[model samples]
Structure formats: C-alpha cells, structure tokens
Target: MAEHGRRRWRLVLTASPLQGHMSPMLHLATFLHSKGFSITMAHSDLNRPDPLNHPGLTFLPLRDNLSATADFAGAGQFLQTLNDNCRPHFQHHLVQIIDSQKEASASEKESIVVIHDNLMFFAGSVAADLGLPSIILRTSSASFFPAINIIPQLLEQGRFPVQGPNNQILDNEEIVSELHPIRYKDLPFLCTPIEQTLKTINMIITKKPPSAFLWNTFEFLEPTGLTHIRDHYQVPVFSVGPLHKIIPTHSTSFHKEDTSCISWLDKQAPRSVVYVSLGSLANVDEKISTEMAWGLANSNQPFLWVVRPGLVKGFEWFEFLPEDLVNQMKMRGLIVKWAPQKEVLAHSAVGGFWSHCGWNSTLESMFEGVPMLCQPFELDQKVNCRYLSDVWKIGVEIVAERGEIEDAIRKVLVGKEGEEMKQRAIEIQEKVKVAISHGGSSHNSLEAFVDYILSL
Candidate 1:
C-alpha cells in the first residue's frame, strides 16, 4: 500500500523462487508498508506473487528463463543458473525503475532501497552499480552463516564425510563450540553432494556484503546465532521476525492454499490433531509415505496432512496405498495439496506439527506454541531440527518407520513429555510475544532497521 506521512520511502525487494523464501520477503514488504513505506516486489517469474493478493504493491517479474519442463538439477547448479539468467535482465529493469523514479514528483518518487535474498545476490551488485542502498534478507535461520563459516577448518581437520554409513559422526562428534548444540554432522552444507554444496556455499560467501542483514528470526530463539552472525559479518543485523505475525500480512503463497482443513480441524478436540506438512520442497519415497500414513492412522489421533503434488518421489499422492488403509486414513484424516499453514497451525485443534523443520515452519510452529516431530530433509533444515529437538527440547526426532511415527505423534499430542514440550513452547512463545511488542528486542531491532533505512 502507499506510504502514509510526509517522510516517504520505498523498498524494491526480490526473493528466491521457493515458497519458504518468497513468503518472508513478502511479509517484510507488508510489514514495512505498515510503517509508512511503499513497497515494490521484484520476483523471478518461476514463482511470481500475484498482484491480486497484494493490492497496493507493484510486482516486477524478471525473466528467470527456467523451462517448466527442464529436468531438475541439484540445488547448487539450479541456483547458479538462476543467478546467471536473471542478472542482466535484473540490472536492466532496475535501471529502468531508477530512471523512471527520477521523473516522478518528490512525494511519489520516495527514496528507494534495493533489498534482496542472499540467493539473489546479483540484485545487490545491480543496486551498487546504480548508487542505491541495498540490504540482504536472510529468509533462513540466523545460525546459518556461522555454521557454514567453519567448514574450511573442519575440512582441514579431516572432518569431512564424518559418517560413512556406519560411523558415529552423525551421532555427535566434535561439537561446534561457536554455535553449541550443533555438531559437525548437523551442518546444512552436508545436506547435498559435497562438490555441489561447496559450490553453493562459495557463491554465497563471495557476494559483496550489503548495508545490513535482516533475518526472519527473533533474539530469544537464536541468541548465539544472531550474535555470531553480527559479530562475524561486522554489519548491522536485525532479527525482526515471526514477520507474518509482526504486521499480519496477506498470503504470498506460490501455490493455492487449501483452507478446507481448517473446518476439519474445527470438529476435533483442542490439541488433538497432528498437522503434517513437509513444506514446498522435501520429497519422500513411497515406503516413507506408506509408513507415515500407517503411523498417523495408528497414533489414533485425528490428523491433517499436506501431500503436495510429486511429494512422493516418482509417484503421485498415495495411490499405492491399499484400499483399506486409504479408507482408514479418509475416516481419520484430511489431505490437501497445500494447507494455509499459519491458519492450520493456529487452529485450536492443532496440537503438534510434523514438519521438515524449514526455518519458516519452525518459527511458525514456535509462534503458534505448537511442538514438533522433526524430519528435516536438507539444507538449514537439519540445523534447525537439531536445535529444536536437542537444544530447545520442544521437538522429537522421528523416522519414517510406522512405530516411531506413531509414538512421536502420540507423544507430541497427548503424552506427559508432550505436555512438557508444549509448556516450554508456550513459555517461549510468551517471551516471543513480548519481543514483538513495544520496548522488546525484535521490536527495537525492527525500529533500528527502519531508522537505518531512513538514514540513507
């Protein structure tokens, strides 16, 4: 929406194509708009935010040149391609916008700040070339940077490939002293092939530093992470998060969110349904899906699950399940392509979240005071899962085995341990509530971020 008041400003923001990344960037834009700054969202065409969903904001789509039919490459190569294809187009469009703004009246033009996701670092260089201020929006956890920074030393110490399918490195080898509760095995860098992981990490590291780093994380949840990143980066760092709640924005979902589950949740008892969603990425095999279905059914708890198209590797939605089990699941659960996550989590019947532990999901679960069954698939998700299960003690690590999934679901939904974790979650959520209110850390940091932006 348009900025209100005399001193005006505008934010031209861009985000990675993934839903997890796009949601927070849009939330940031929405939140900043509330603070009297106009917003323009520049996005890749692959997952463009709908102009209808965001009434007052402008949507500038950059040519991603990604074929919908192209075979999917690994994360590293895919990101490299996105950057390469979008750079020249991004620069040209940015220059056009800058030149156009120069022709507008003072009130309409407003000062512009180019804010972009770390994965879209090309935007930062374009902004730098245009002599405009730029900021980095880290959509993942604050702990990510420091964890990746130590990889060189860990490699020198011969810690690479710590676990060889029969080793104990995954169990807990040398602890990362700087970011405690995270060991070598839990590093997000190892989530992909080593060469590719290094390729992506190198791309991230070599980008020019921005004026500031805005993290979608709060202080209480990652004090050490925020501390480490700020100290290491030596730039202004702001943790203004649960951004979806900060200003309560409209959805920027790349996929249409099925809201019918909310009504299904209405009939269940308070804290009775276990909501399972693996987010926009993470794919599981048929075996895992079958086991998960049996587990949710066996837990004897009503559940809601998001079975995204192609979520099962090489298969469609659980068509392979036997008719009887499918019938049982139909009796007790609701499955949608994608649920309105925040609404689902906030529902009174949702007691637990079976998640992929993506940072956005983690923060949403924590903010809603819902405990989790952690099944991190890749990237920073592993780091967040470790912190949730081992450090915060609010989540339980789960496997795809029917028995384990059943037990974990039951534990989170009804057991004493579940109660304890729920209490801690609620307690942490209370503090988080305070943090977003006036005179709190996130509130203060957000204010400082706004002030810093205005200072330019």
Candidate 2:
C-alpha cells in the first residue's frame, strides 16, 4: 500500500524508443504512480506514449537525431546515436526542471530521482552530475541479465569474432560451466561488430552505477540468475514484477491492436487455436514465411497469426503468401496485422503460442498458462528460449522447416506432450499469482523497493 501523506516524490523516467524497451518502463511508471508518486517521462520525440493512455503521468520530449525514427541500423549504432545525442539535451532539460521546481511554493514542491531503462544509461550519468539519486530498470528476465556482459568476458579471452565464413565462436558448441547449460552459441547474439559491441558494453557499465536495479522478474522464475546479479552488482536489486498482473495498464503498443482477431478466436473450440507472433523487430526470410503458412495449414489446428507489416524482410507486408496455399490457410486460420496479445492468450481458444520468444511475449504466454513453440530470433531471446525449454520444461523449440514447424505446433496444441507442457504451465501460472499476493516474495520485494525509494 502507498504511504499516506507522502505525495511529494517526483520520478523522472527515460524510455528507450524501441517497442520492447518502451513497454516495461511504462508499466513501471504506472506501478509507481499508483504508489502516489508523480511521473515525468523523458523520451525521444518518436514513439512517445499517448498521454491519454497514462492519464496521471507527464510526458517530456527531448530533441531527437534522425536515427530515432529510421530503421534500426544495428545495435551499437542505435545505442551510440541515442546516448550521444540525448546526453546533452537530457542534461539541460533536467537542469531546467530542477530550477523550475525550486521556484514553486514549498507546499507544491517535490523531490526528484532519475529512473531509466538499462539501455538509457546516459540518464543515470546526467542525474549523478546533478547530485540526484537514480535507478535502472532491467526490461528482460533476471536469468538473461548476467548473460548480457558475456561478450566482454569472451573478448578478454581472445576467442570472439568467431573465425570463418559462418559465425561460430571457438567454443560455440561447448557448454560454459560458469553459465551452466548455455553454450557460447546460445548467448544473446550481439548484432554489432566486435569493436562496436565492446564499445557499447564499456559505455553502459563504466559510469557510476545506479542506486538500484528493478527487474521485471520474480524469485520463482529465476532465483539463481537473481542471485548472480545481487552478488555481482553488490547493490540493492528488487524483483517486483510480472507487473502486468500487478496493475493492468493501458496499451503502450506501437501498432494499433487489431481486436477483430478476438472474434475469430471466439468462433473456435476451446484449446484449439495456435497463436503466432514474431514480435516487432524480428524479420523472417520469405521462404520461411511461406513454409510457416503451409506448416500451420498442415497442422490442422485452428490458428490466429499476427503477420504485421515488415515481417518478411524487404517486403512492405506479408502479401506474398503463395497464391496456391492462400485458400488452404483461409480455411483454418485468421491472419491479422497485429493483436491484443494478453487478451488473446487468455482466451479459451488459444492452446499454444508459436513465438519469437521476446521477453514480453514470453511473460504473457506464461501468465496465461499457454504452452509455447519457441523460435528465438536473436539477442536476449536465445537466452530466454533456452530457459523456457531446458530450465522450465514448458516450451518446445522448433527448426525452421515446414515439417518440423507443423510437428512442434501439434506437440503444443493437441498431443499428450502438449498436455504435459500445459499442466506445467498451469502450475507456474498459479505460482505467479501467489508471488503477487500479500506477503509473497514479489509482494515483499515491492514493499522493500518502496521503502528504499522513500529513504533515498
């Protein structure tokens, strides 16, 4: 519960422009606002949250470089441009906010703190420069958190840049004992050149670290990973999440959610539909898309597929579904440009998810007790897919071939194997509910986080 008569704390949050980064930060903002703190979202001009979606929070715009709205060039370039360009603008803007607040009457005044997504480390630096406390929010799972710094470790050992025409580290196939069960190949794929990757890594961690890190994960999900982070950082780390369930916030989606898919789902039988979405950034090969369409049709299970614009690389939209198989897919599938994923997952018709294994989608699927057909694309997704399939035993991974795709979808939706996976998922879903309840781990952690903030 929020402390009574303590409404003078104001939080300044910086949200990264990517869809994946924007989401969890906004949910955190909503969660904090409910605890009686005022929120000011300092973000790039592109992909700004709709003020109507979050009524109580304020949105502040920072100047943007052209790269803000352009297609992602690469990981390092994107972060370098965002951090280098936004640093001075954000610093100056924060100074102005601090000065303006000083002029207000004491009764109307509020103390300030800077909280931001992990990628936006520049915010913490700016805050430290002005002598204010700041916090960092990790948008991915706790298990995936420590794996992020692995690239630097590999580089130090002189084994990176993966010799040869194909991308394979010297120890790509070996199980890393320190990482336990994850191979070098399975570490989050850094999409930038080795030098750029090193540069990006150095930039984010070399600064004075934040006061705390707030993870969008709970103890039951990845206790070991959480422990690794606490030992490594030696700072206050809070696991107060599955925040979507804690407080249901309005859509921070970049695309308009197509509600029409819900009606298609309504017409299907219970536990009969396979839901597919590849998230916002992953691009599939044209051949793979064609094969996936045929594979879904071959599975004979009813399915709802989100084929958003740019799903097939170099194409405007997924209009290239082979003219021959179009009729077959129409008979048993509903295709939409986008979907309201949380609602779709909860619907009785959705029995399985064929996903790119993005962290947000992974958490949503887990929350609804739906088994997953994991097809991790890159970066943190590979780490998440590994845990879901190996650690949790609730997901089935698939190769990109049509025959394998069909079999995996069936295994999650209709076969006895799917039933077993569904049961395990249901068990975890129940645990999730308990974690957010009174006196639970996540619940207590949230209380601790609040007290820590108040103390600061």
Candidate 3:
C-alpha cells in the first residue's frame, strides 16, 4: 500500500481486442486500481472500451490501419495481423505514457509497470526496450498456457501437425506433460495449419518471459495445471482470479447487454431454464443453428438464449428461425442479442448453461453454481470443456445433432443425473466464493501480486 505522504505508483495495462480477452484484463485493471495503483489503459481502436466508463484511469487508444471489421481467414491469421498492425502503435503510446509519468513530481514518478494480455506478443518487447518491469496476464486457464510452450516436443515426436491414418491422430488420447490427458482434437489453436502453428510457437518461445505470469484462475480450481506450469517454467506464477467475482462492476462486453431477460427468468421456477450462448466470436452453420433451435424447443424446457447478430452463417438475426419454431419459442423461450450473462446465471430460474465454454463464461457459471451443457467451439474452450466434464464433473458435452442436443438438455435440466451435476456445480461455486474472499487462496495471491508491483 502507498503511504499517506507518498505518491501512488502507476501501472499501464493492455489487452487483445477480443471480448473474452478484454473482459478479464479490464477486471484486473479495476482490481489493481482499488489497491491504490494509478491505472493507465493502452488499447487498440478495435472494440475499445469507453474511457468515460473508467473515470480514474487514463485511456490511450492506439491507432491501427486495420479496420475492426477486416476479415481474417482464421484465428491464427487474425492474431498475426493484430501483432503486425498494433505493435508500433502500442510501443509508441507505451513510451509516451512512461515518459509522461517520468515528468511528474518525484513522488508521483515513483515507478511504472506494464501488465499486458498474453496474446499481445509485442508488449514484452516494449517493456524490455523501455527498461521497465512487466507481467503477462493470461486470460485463459493455467492449464492451457503450457501447451504453447510444448509445440516443439509435439512436433519432434510426430504427434502434432497431427497426421495419421483416417485422421486417427485426433483420437489418440496421449498424456502430454504440461497438460491433462487430451487428444489432438482438444489442443488449443489446433485448426491452424502446421506452418502457422510453427510461427505462433516461434513467437511465443522467442520472447523474453515476463517477470511474472498472472492467470485468471484460482489455485484450487486447477492445482495440477498450476503445478505443471510452476515446475517447468522459471518465471513467478500467480493464480488470482475468477476475476468477475473480484471486480463485478467493471463492464467488458463489446455488445450492449440486455438485462430484461432477468424479468423473464424471474417468472420461471428454480433450476428450470437453460441459458444458451455461443460467445462473441464462434459462428455456427445454418444446419447446426437450426438443430439447436428445434432441440431446445423439443426439450420442453424454458430457456434464455443469446443469438448475437452474426452467430449463424448466411442468415439474418433470428430470421433463420422457421415460423413454427418461432411460435414454440414464444411459448417457453426468450431470445436476445446479448445478455447480462452474470446476472442471468445468478437468476433462480437458470438451471444449466448451454455454452461454448469460453473461460470467462465457464467461470461465471461456476461462480453462480449453474451446471453446463458444453458445446465447445474452439481454442481454450475445448480444454475448458474437458475439465468441466471429466475433472470437475459439472457439465456434459453435446454434439450438434438435434437428438443429441435434446438428450443433453434433458439430462441436465430434468433427470437424476442432472441433479448430481447441479450439486457438484453448487459445491464448486462455494469454493470459488471462498477463494476470492479475504484471506482466501485467490485473495492472498492477489495481495502478493500487488506487493510485487509496488516493490518494483
């Protein structure tokens, strides 16, 4: 903590433009600000947070030629473009902020640190060039972080680039050292071609590791995964998260959230509604979207669904719903473009989450004690879904077929099996609350992190 007569230290924070990445990063900034550090946010123009929303913080929006709507062929390409386009802007603004702080009175110029999203590869370089300490804020699980570090080993063993008879490589359940037992299919960024994979691997491995690695997860939630990272990597690691629980007022959604769904939920019975959303970026084909609609209708369960504008390929928003399907939804469903997700999960009527298992959503559901019906779309979501079902026993994965979807929903919302899952979810929810409270594991870790930043 800063002394009464001394000036507060400043911390500059940056994040990738994506919603999932930006949300947690902002929450972290809020948490640190509450701890007495002056906050400075450096962000790209794409999906930029309104500076007015965060009054005490300094907001720097960096310029980039890339349009927010520019189409990338895939996630890897998008990431590569972000790094290329944002690097100079980020570095330039970062330098300006550091210099500005230096010009402040000696007490106010005590120290400055940079904490950046792990995906913004250029942040580490900028920190080094400026001779400042930095920390990497990993938006995903600690379990998923080491996968990037082991791509070389996987290639040497001929396990990655995942080629084999009949695409059999995806079926092989090999236990990789840093990760839990997983098939090739569960690997993060697996859809990227081998060449792109190598490029990403090189980018990550070549960078100077930051002074500390901060994960948006609690120690108890992923003990084994945390241990693996600490044992293999030399940098200091801190697990100080389920950040939504810590900083609830920080808004991170790129889209305006609809809070009206809470009233609809209030009309339903406890543990009856299945909350459905596919996150901000995942798009489903028309076939899968149609199947999901009918499946939800057939389950005879009330639901609150978020159908983002571009959620379905080649269809207008909710126009893809057939007339009869629309009528059925009117009877038992509520649809919105975007939802106040944390609020929806906390509602009494929500029994389960039908989700893409994005880490933020998963943690939110866990924090609320809502079981999941997982349909993992891509990247770390797949890994998170694996842990939800196999390790945590709080969710069940669903296939895209109507029958499979219906069955999974029925199992989670009605049957004895569903009750068991709900009980487990509630148990985890209690543990999460404890972890974020004072003197809890996550609380202690957060305090330690603050102390480190102040010391520097």
Rank ordering of all candidates by TM-score, starting from the highest: 2, 3, 1
Candidate 3 wrongly placed segments (more than 4 Å): 1-8, 97-105, 164-179, 204-207
Model 1 misplaced stretches (Cα beyond 4 Å): 1-8, 100-110, 163-174
lDDT digits (tens) for residues 358-394 of candidate 2: 8888888888999999898887898888888888989
What's the lDDT for residue 92 in model 2?
Answer: 89
The alpha-carbon lDDT assigned to residue 375 of candidate 3 equals 95
Output the better candidate (1/3) by TM-score: 3
Q: Report the Cα RMSD per candidate.
A: 2.5, 2.2, 2.2
Candidate that beats the other on TM-score, 1 or 2, i.e. the better one: 2
Candidate 1, residue 105: the lDDT equals 82
- Local accuracy of candidate 1 as per-residue lDDT tens digits, 1-456: 334354467688999888888998888887777776778788888877888877678888889888644676776777888888888877887777778877888666767789988888788888888898899988888777678777766666777647666544454556777668787767876645667766778877644578888988888888888888877778898999878778866787777888887888899999999999998878898989999999998999999999998899987787878899989999889989999998999999999999999998998998899999999887788888888998889999998899999999999999999999999999988988999999988899989998888887
TM-score, every prediction? 0.93, 0.94, 0.94
Using lDDT, rank the candidates from best to worst.
1, 2, 3
lDDT tens digits, residues 131-245, model 3?
Answer: 9888988878877766666766787787775657776445446666556665567776665677777777676543567888888898889887798777766778889888877
